[model samples]
Target: MAKIYLDPGHGGTDPGAVANGLQEKVLTLKIALKTRDILNRDYEGHSIRMSRTSDTTRSLSQRTNDANSWGADYFVSIHINAGGGTGYEDYIYNGSVSNNTITYRDKLHAEVMKQVDFRNRGKKRANFHVLRQSSMPAVLTENGFIDTTADANKLKSDAYLDRIALGHANGIAQALGLKRKSGSGGSGKQGYVEVITPSLWTYNTANWDDKAVIVNEGEVFTVARDKFKVGNGHMYQLKSGLYITASTQYVRYYTK
Candidate 1:
């Protein structure tokens, strides 16, 4: 199993950045914890570790040392931005441009921008302590500007944080080249499909009337083909065992 380290920047006494009643430490921990859940649930073999699982102060050395000593494959630092910018961005060490960290950051930045409706601040590079000290390919993400009213408004919503966490998890999954295969009962196998439309509806049966959800937008869920619905124009089963339209209007399934 590939080892992964997650660092939620600042906690307890540190508190990192704060603005508009949002503290960076709390937000980072929430995102990091959620990312761990997603990684464990979706990607099977990788082991995940967090620098601080609770609201406690942890030194930068301890964070890097733990990961280095354990031989983590990737190090991800989660934090919120300050100053004035109103969007999301990520960072790597100064000389990491030629390595896989850039690939991870690119996928991460693209995935977040695709779902969160945030302005693209672009992936960046800096001499941050976590990035420079970690032995593995490391990435530091500036989720959003806590100081910006618009960004802070989104940060205040748990729904927004869920999407942000999923986006970051998607980046980590892609960076690790993890496979999430869906077992199609009859017509071979099909992988996951991400929701792309503004809203998608789900139902209990292929032609049944009971609605499973009001609307699912910008969410990625597991899917497998229903052999019974093959004649009904290829209906797919969701993770919840509910049914939804698999058209391009709602989902996009990528190959390789």
Candidate 2:
């Protein structure tokens, strides 16, 4: 299992950067937490840890040390930049430019960039403390310039923060080749296709039984080993070992 350490830059007394109504510490923590949650909920085969789960202060040395001790495969430090610019940018240790860190950074940067309105500042390099000190591959991301008016307004929205978190989570998954772990039922695997219709019914039998569970809209699940045609519709096994609809009106996917 690959290990990833998320360090939400600055906390407690050290606010890091600030502007408008958003503080860098708070923003970073929010994004970092989201990233972790996404990785845990949607993917498998990862050991994820965080430097700080709350507003507790932590030093750079302490953060790196904790990750190092844990033998993390990757370290991601989340922060918001200052100095009146607007947009997103990411970094790796300067001297290790051509290494895997860049590959991971590039994937993450692209995922995040496509989802946000911030100006693309491009991937960069630096001698940041966490990058230079961490034994494993490390990156520090300046999500956006908190001091910029446009960027600050973007940060103020819950949706914007979700985009940032999604970008980072996708990057991590791409870098590690992590597989989808589950559907809405927490069955340890995601659905082959999303539930597009209002809802679909689970069957007690492949032939369509009298009573069954209701899988609602937006839920995903893996196709099962068994399938059968029931009237004008079809059914397949859910990852949960139950039967569900395989009809176009209920779900938008094909079983392998």
Q: Could you say which candidate leads in lDDT?
A: 2
- The residue-by-residue lDDT of candidate 2 on 22-99, one tens digit each, is 899999999999899878877888999899999999999999999999999989999999998777889888885446
TM-score of each: 0.71, 0.71
* Cα shift from native, residue 50, model 1 (Å): 0.5
lDDT of 1 by residue, 1-256 (tens): 7788999999989999988998999999999998888666566568888999999999999999999999998899999999998888888998744468778778877766544656668878899899999888999998889999988987887756766787787778778886653541211234456677778777787764566785556677677553223332335677677777654435664322
- What residue pairs are clashing in model 2? 181-188, 181-189, 182-189, 182-190, 191-221
Alpha carbon lDDT of each predicted model: 0.77, 0.79
Task: Find the number of clashing residue pairs for candidate 2.
Answer: 5
Residue 135 Cα positional deviation in candidate 2, in Å, after optimal superposition: 0.6
